[model samples]
Target: MTQGPIRLDIAVGYATPRKGLPSAVSFRRWATAALAGRIREADLAIRLVGSKEGRALNRHYRGKDYATNVLSFPADLPEGLPPGVRMPLLGDLVICAPVVAREAREQGKSLNAHYAHLTVHGALHLLGWDHEDSREADAMEQLEREILAGLGLDDPYALPGD
Candidate 1:
């Protein structure tokens, strides 16, 4: 099915002078690219945050105390909307800049590439894709690989020891 245009919003809340943070244009590009052929329309927000805020959100929401790379919060609209109602709001993404940067450096991946992968990954999650099990993980990872490749990025799952 043909997809429609995308509407993305981005916010940066980190105080640290981090390097390699993607621009709003790049975020839009990555998100729109990931949503291509998947959703006809999307209204999503991407928020770049520090480890403190990221950790707080993780702890409150997922019961995890550490800051993660990316967290997805899908829209919780009613299952059945009234007639003529269009819920284009997909969800929000909270990306910890420091964590992403550190992971990219440690994993030997480019910062932009890692950000692209995470953006795509979070977008997928907003669209109801998940990796809760081996089968689901394989499928999600395959899709992520395809999406990242389309953006001229390498497979994010490749380990350095491979």
Candidate 2:
């Protein structure tokens, strides 16, 4: 399915001249477009921060001590047919750049590929996809696999292949 362009509201907490990823806005836009589903006009905030802040948010929200790849917080909107024209406002997708980079290296993948996967994964969450159970986990993984494959990335589940 072809997706239209989107406007991203990005906030970088730890910007540097010589460190971190480049062209993040473009990266996010591509990922969003790659996973376009029910989300219309999204209010996305991709915060690129250090490990400390990442860990704090993870522990407070997800009960995880260390930083994770991505976190999605979807806004609770009324679930009914709406009158007039109101685009759905998908909530935030926060990604810890350092953690993503580390995971990419450890997983033997490129930073771009990892970013794409996390971005797609977080977007899926914003569209209400969770992995708490076997059925949900399988469905989410299938979607992730399809999205990553569309971006020409390898399967995130399969072991690092030749």
Candidate 3:
């Protein structure tokens, strides 16, 4: 069944310099693509941070020392809401600009494309998609590939010779 357009109220915040970074519109587009057909409405925040803040958040949240790429924080809605009440608050996404740039350069991919992939990946995470195990990882990766392809981007997980 075809679903209607997703109603997204995405707030983009830049904790780092805006220069050489993807604009808020691009992020919103990527997020909407990820949410379309899966959700009807959403309210989420996407924060772009520098390496320092990214590293700190990663360390504090995931116990990782360095900043990875994108971090997804799903919303924790309050309990005791009336039945049939759906919360449109989808949590926040933190993207480390430096890490993304570095990875793009290292992987020989365009910066904008990398950002799109990360944004989509993070959005899926917000929707309760996880890759804690191999099976889950494969499914998530395939979904990501499909979403990116729909966005006219190359497969992010493709090998060098593929």
* TM-score against truth, every candidate: 0.85, 0.77, 0.91
The residue-level lDDT of candidate 1 at 31 comes to 90
Compare candidates 1 and 2 on TM-score and give the better one. 1
Give the winner by lDDT: 3
* Tens digits of lDDT, candidate 3, 1-162: 238766889999999999999999999999988999998888999999999999999999899999989999888544533576457888899999999999999998899999999999999999989999999999999999999999999999986568
For residues 1-162, write the lDDT of model 1, one tens digit per residue.
455664544443434454657787888889988888887776788888889999999999999999999999887545654577456767888999989989999999888999999999999999888999999999999999998889888889999766
Over all chains combined, what TM-score does candidate 1 have? Answer: 0.85
Q: Over 4 Å off in model 1, which ranges?
A: 1-19, 77-86
Note the residue pairs that clash in candidate 3.
Answer: none
> In candidate 1, residue 11 scores what lDDT?
43
Worst 10 residues of 3 by lDDT: 77-86
**TM-score computed on alpha carbons, candidate 3:** 0.91
The per-residue C-alpha lDDT of model 1 at residue 148 equals: 88
Global lDDT of each candidate: 0.84, 0.70, 0.92
Q: What is the lDDT of residue 78 in candidate 1?
A: 51
